[model samples]
Target chain A: MCIAPVDEMRKNHMTMLLHQRDKTVQQGIRGQPASLTGCIDCHVTPDASGTVARSDDEGFFCTSCHRAASVKIDCFECHADRPAEMISQLDWKSLNPINHSSLLAINQQSFPYALQFRLETRSMALNQ
Target chain B: MNKIDQYRRKFLGAASAAFVGITIAPGILLQAGNAATAGQGVSDAQRWGLLIDTNRCEPGCDACVQACNKENGLRSIHGPKTDAQWIRKVSLKNRKNGHVLNMPVMCQHCAKAPCVDVCPTGASFKRADGIVLVDKHTCIGCRYCMMACPYKARSFVHEKLTDQLPHAPRGKGTVESCTLCVHKIDRGDNTTACVQACPHGAMMFGDLNDPDSAISKQIKSLGSQQLRKKLDLDTGVRYQGIPV
Candidate 1:
């Protein structure tokens, strides 16, 4: 569950997301808790067929809420509605072999310190 | 006052000062840490650019184009007109001298970008480091940027894309062009996929503002040409060895 209350999130999530987008896309400030990718990673629910996506399914988290509110969700139109695992596997090292550290640094900034530490430990355990 | 009273007042003053310092210490440290990290943000002092030596570009070579497609996950849908091509090889021949030159053309990343000016939603914008990109979330698929662009470099996605790099998020209906590998640039990578793929050493990527940068030095010594210099767009990309 997110840090915010469900009721508050349901009412003001869009405002939070918009603020996050401005900070991230415009000002290049990332790794905040309100990132869209983080939201999808946490809240996405799988349908009966075990497919989790934003559209073409009524059970998806964003779709269900937007459908209920009758508000158009245009983010899915251009962005992946699911988590990174559901998308194509990206070989980050191959993409920029020379600057993988910088890539990792940017990714590190995307999450809070506690989550980031947990993720690092999990990855380290997996690697071992 | 007695010596004990004066000492007590001095102790209280010092203790209050220590308390105030302790109260603000974390915030001060955080600001310092942020200043160190915030240096990663694109700065106006650096104008990232690319220089193509057309004379060195092999005519049959499509390595750069192929690499770009692979890097960006641009798949051809059998629609020659609609397929997104971030970069393409163009062969130019001098009419009188019959001299032929081949060069790759992509987004110019202009200082005075027409696409940015014409964009109704302001999704088309140039970064502080001079790489122009489409904020896909707000693009609205208007295609106004396509019309405004003089280079015909931008393309509209005709279909949905399932296989997309997390770094390069593209989708149907949004107008996209050569980002100059913005993901790489933002991560402080000095090279682009096309620049790395060019086997003939035809492409050079570096900071244009830095006098010592390879592209800047090359432009100064060899004399590079912008595609449409008349527009005074101050494009970040330049080409050398093209017949005037």
Candidate 2:
């Protein structure tokens, strides 16, 4: 029927209106800063030497906004509650099997080879 | 006579001041002198221990295993059984003595934990209270922890994690093991699955900090021994499988 053409035109107009509305909404949504990455974005502190910034295991930096955003934080479920500075001071990495075994002599004496390894790394940096 | 009296009064005042100083100084000295005293008075003492009694333990109880799974958010998979158990009730027989012992085998939570040292990501570390645990977020799934564990306490998850706790979700490719129910311990509940599940009261859980605690008293009375003492892991869990 002749009414079918008018209906089609009307449908086309509605689609165009919807498309325009969608375009406007999309445009409004654009150009805004993205959502918070959390944890990954923060907790990274420059080393005492200030040459590099690294993340502590607990993600305290990321937690700054987590509390603000009302996100339940549970880093301590696996990580320690103490600050990374204290953990680093304990020479914890030296206790690892690969590192600690190297510290022991054939006679099983606790030698200082692990300390030497770190000194060697620092020397390598100094040499550079 | 007045000058002499004035000098005598001044001398008496000085003597009184000296007497007061002598008395007060020693009291203050005694109070401050014991600052470096040893034993319980020392604030920084760390006494780590573990207790495993075969008598009270169930032979094949998986309560500790399953409890650890839920507490740590370990998901069991169908394919290869990755990300399953952090603690398992292992039945062991001494070849020499021909004696069987039921032990809940998990992270020994060693004082000198091997997994902690081998981690390049610093994911594994011992807490101040001496509980060894893995920080899953930092765990790179390098399998170094699995290799480092002499007791075979750790396992790796191959499958991606779903249905995880919002607080502590299981991450893929990370190593996990029994945390000694640390989350519960932190929440003021001392019971881990193995300890709570052992209907016979085989496993004893308590803060080693308290000398009066049952675990501390049990170790003292029973003279518990650590597994692989030759390794010098300084394990917190002690085994009293044999008669003292």
Candidate 3:
């Protein structure tokens, strides 16, 4: 399932990602729903060939749309294009969904109004 | 510089520098409350810090350093000179007695970090909670922050890095350093990887902003020292038992 409808995501993902990147990088907010990592986790998967597609590949999730629009993105240059599980062989605690931290928090005043519907107070992201 | 002059210069700074202590929050002395969930930005009210008891740090123990590399997925085919070492065991030996002391050193996470000042693109920054990080998106690989750092903490990625862990995103040409295990911190796992992996319990990680924090109380009771204290960096990392 998508976080938002296909049309809505296609239209405004860049802006949502922009907000998420700044918050995560500068403000140390990782619980936000629009994180690029979150998107890659669900979207960038292996096909029947059992090969995971990189951003440069035409069959890649982000690349297919971006290539169609002729919009070049540099996000994959520094960020991991693969899912967390695919990147590291080590069984890091962070990669385990069972051990993943709660992600319900996102109620800062600076957050976008449209996205605030799903936002909850900081208390919602209590450490489990 | 000659040996004597170098010795004099080093001592000159050490002479003026004193022990680092907890001077904030007169009497509150209460442990900081739990952090808000993942959705929230790290609170400025909590300044993360590490306290290392060098007296307890054992020689030849690389647990903390190994843990750091594993946690950050930092692998290197090259030797020490080119390899990324976010945390390394620093051995200090007394000239006369040949006594050896050991401690782990990484980014000090300074309150007034010089790396933040020298970055032309503002990529080098201190998080409001006191974790120093290089925002690779804004970093142009200029390496000015690397030079400005007094701790020699930051390292530049020379070759194309493939398959970096999501928890620690690194790339070619950008400068990076110790993040104090920000990924874990943001997830509300309060301890750093180095501190977690230390077998001797030589390291402590906590919120320095909280007067009652274990680290703050330790700094209060035992006293700690910041390396190169003459610079007055107000480093987040502190050490105990540096033979001054």
Candidate 4:
């Protein structure tokens, strides 16, 4: 269920993310497993209004833990904190569709609870 | 050992192996993947450069300047003196002969960039592919690079920024200048906004290291001159048809 051991991820996730950013930005490497977009797509939670939350939102995954640990997250100053689809349609177009589809498949299978809520809300809106 | 015990031992060994493999596979795969893409990294093998035919440049034509502003989302919020001008059109006239010419000037992207040398924080740097860039993350807002640059290329962000492009992230209190459209270059685009916007083909962008490249061929055939060549910066940008 976890990408890595919870203890390891908790302790070294920032280092891992920083390393990934350097590789992706400086070296032009994309579609890596430690991508920030991939993490946001999986870990982002919706608010009571059924909209994906922003980084400043109280219960947002990264912010919630970072706040508890007294660590300030500066990434969202330039990067979108929510899922790609929620941020910009242009981003959705630019994203590698193969990675998107594969991540979607894995997300559906592994995190059915989150997927079901999103699906049900989408379907309800479609019916209306 | 009994058959049942032997079977159980085999299962335990297999499970342990699988666990180890699963735990180690991602790191190994990541390394392989990085190696596979290392060829895509910017390298000294190809130094990207520009050739500007100043004779072809039209006076009163600000297309290149306008295009750069639009591309990088730079606006003159504070007046011309304080605003960032990544690229500017310069007009030169011969005092003795009455000869006149117009040209665009920007960061020279020098081989031995003074800005890179003068920056105490090492934020001003030249990439492997000969592109000069300011790593804003480490820039401490000192204007040493600005003072060091002979072309007067670097600009210090004096005001807050809003509605910034995600690809070209600009912030307050950072020295920035023409990155030679590095984001576009990294995305595999060969031309900069100025080059693309030049209707008269006044600007050319290509790999200077490649003899077959248009910029290189132009430089060789016509003999381009670098601005302030006496300084021996070996600038990536070359100019042609300017009255001496």
Candidate 5:
């Protein structure tokens, strides 16, 4: 089940997200009913062809509703629309070896920094 | 700015926001008084801090810098003039004996942060837990806080940023600095990227307010001093082994 009913989320998701943002940012409270990253993890997924839809794509989760309403989502401008694990699963060929640290943490699943050396070495090797 | 760069930013953002579900630190709940919330609230009861052991810091190693860039999704834009360097390695040399000291330097996260004092929009503020941050929501990109910072810690985003890490949402027209990985801290991660990535264990982090915490104990036992101590900023980060 969704955090809220799909209709309820559609109507008031922005307010909920903002509330969560403030609570998390200012209060350091992590538990909440809604968050941008949590929403992306659930709503957005790559196709079997290994391609995730961009915000511009009509089939994209947020864009599907917003495009018809003609409201643009400014969230994805700074926040990633996809979860981090999915980004790592993306093929290395499509990823910019220099511009991004994607394709990191394939072996280490602990903390984000657990695999920094591996990522640094991987990106350096790719650059060469 | 271009198509590939936009795509790359999104990918990098995901990469950083990913790997956040690791196990919580062992002593997080062990800390007393604040035990009721399971580390959910930010209060002055806990002052987050880092102690860098300069003796262990490798002179040429940039692991901490690289890890910070990867963790925060910071990439060079034009060059040194416009790059957002949240953490950097600096070497200090003495002409008398040629004594050299190299250490990682970023936002000192002072109790009396100059950036927080100068922000016109109240965007630069300190958390109750002593993590100084730039509130991107209210920031007007005035660059006043950047000018006031004593450690030269703050940076302004000149080019439009895309696909910023969901946890660390930065954008153009805003000044940003080392958040001390506030996103990770808020989520109950005990250490920051630079501390965790240090190959020589040069960096240690914990609640500075807790007497029993490793950071406080080490600062008491091993001894450390802040940068610009005379400024009376009461910095959260402290350094060890700076030559006299």
Candidate 6:
């Protein structure tokens, strides 16, 4: 079995949770899926009537998992809390790794000096 | 003026509703007690904290990991992998910017912890002062806490904790993660293994609760972000963007 990448270990763990949380949403629990795999799957918009799915709603198949696991979830945090099909119109590729390296480099140099002080203090303690 | 009148009407409606039913939401009530639940005295004067600047983080050093293992009495496994890592170099590539964010992964020590909630036996909990931890003796090895964690910071003991120092105590079957060096912290030591092992000044730890604390002040002025805001974990750990 391919264990998750060390960097994405959290994602890997969430995937297992989603599977384990199967069929438990309506029983008065709140274990929603993590936003790692796909945002649209969890962050669905309301129906055409402008009503969003509730944990007790029949169509909120996704919320069911979260409810069963008793994990309180906020869907709008990752997916656009608008409508279901509209999510497809959003750019999911921005979440991919295409331009991540360059962004990391640009943001890398600006770390603050206070962080430096903590590191130095620890170094002295451990050495002794 | 019609637009202004419309806004005023909406505000009045909300204000009236609030007055009629002034019951504070349970979530809000829980928030007040959260600070005290961690079991540490989090005074405004001294809030413990940690910082890992990805720009400065380097791989292959593993000095912090070595020291943590030694201090915690962890045995070296087949790979340099062990469950008691207070720090590990994590490589991240920002898909949007293509920036390689090499960070040292550890517990964020979140203010609102999901891991603590999911633990059926209450083995996992945050101290009053805000250190998230596990009582190994009480842990049943369910790994439910691990699954609930958004940062993937918790680790499982696959084998027995061996070759440990007489003073260092850890073993198998329970979940473990970075304790912010609780033993060191309890002894009034500010140094953590990762902070000392780092040849570069990559990882920083301090009191975020303290207004004058370095990490707190840096977070306010620098605008760092938690790893996953969507989770609403309210993590004390913050990171500056990594350099190209």
lDDT of 6 by residue, B1-244 (tens): 7999999999999998987666555233333432221432232334466777877876445556656655554443433233334445555443445555566657888888989999998778776456787865467889998788766677777764322332233466778788777656544566677777778887778877777777777778876766655567888677787331
Kindly indicate the candidate among 4 and 5 with the higher TM-score. Answer: 5
Model 4 per-residue lDDT tens digits across residues A7-125: 99889888888887765555456556676777877888676887776678777888888888888866765455666455443432232112222322332243222232234333211
lDDT of 3 at A78: 73
RMSD of 5: 15.5
List the candidate numbers ranked by TM-score, top first. Answer: 3, 5, 1, 4, 2, 6
Which residue ranges in model 2 land beyond 4 Å of their true spot?
Answer: A1-128, B1-50, B79-81, B95-97, B242-244
Estimated TM-score for each candidate? 0.70, 0.52, 0.78, 0.69, 0.78, 0.52
| DockQ of predicted candidate 2 | 0.02
* Consecutive 10-residue window with the lowest summed lDDT within model 3 chain A: A98-107
Measured with DockQ on alpha carbons, how good is candidate 3?
A: 0.15
- What lDDT tens digits, residue by residue, belong to model 2 across residues A1-128? 22136566434533543443222121111111121112222234455774322223233554554556666754333433333343335432232212211211211221122223224333211100
Model 5: per-residue lDDT, tens digit, A1-128? 78998799889998999877765665566656687788888888889997888766788999988878989767765677777786545443332222222212211122122133224323211111
Candidate topping DockQ: 3
lDDT (Cα atoms) of all candidates against the true structure: 0.72, 0.53, 0.76, 0.72, 0.73, 0.55
Off by over 4 Å in 6: A1-128, B1-46, B78-86, B95-98, B242-244
The docking category that best describes candidate 2 is incorrect
Comparing 1 with 4 on lDDT, the higher-scoring candidate is: 1
Q: Can you tell me the CAPRI class of model 6?
A: incorrect
The iRMS of model 3 comes to: 19.2
> TM-score of candidate 6 restricted to chain B?
0.74
Per-residue lDDT tens digits for candidate 2, residues B1-244, read 7999999999999999999989896345333321121211112133434577876676545565555544454544543233345655555444445556566656788888898899998788665557777766567888888887877677676765433443344556778777776545544465675677666777788767788988989877877877666678888888887422
Of the candidates numbered 2 and 3, which has the greater lDDT value?
Answer: 3
* Model 3 residue B45 lDDT score: 87
Candidate 5 per-residue lDDT, tens place, B1-244, comes to 8999999999988876664533243234223234213435566788999999988898767788778877877766665556677875665544445556667778999999988888888889887789999877788999998778766678899887654565677788888899999878766788999999999999998999999999999988988887766678999999998632
Error of 2 at B162 (Å): 0.9
Order by DockQ, highest first = 3, 5, 1, 4, 2, 6
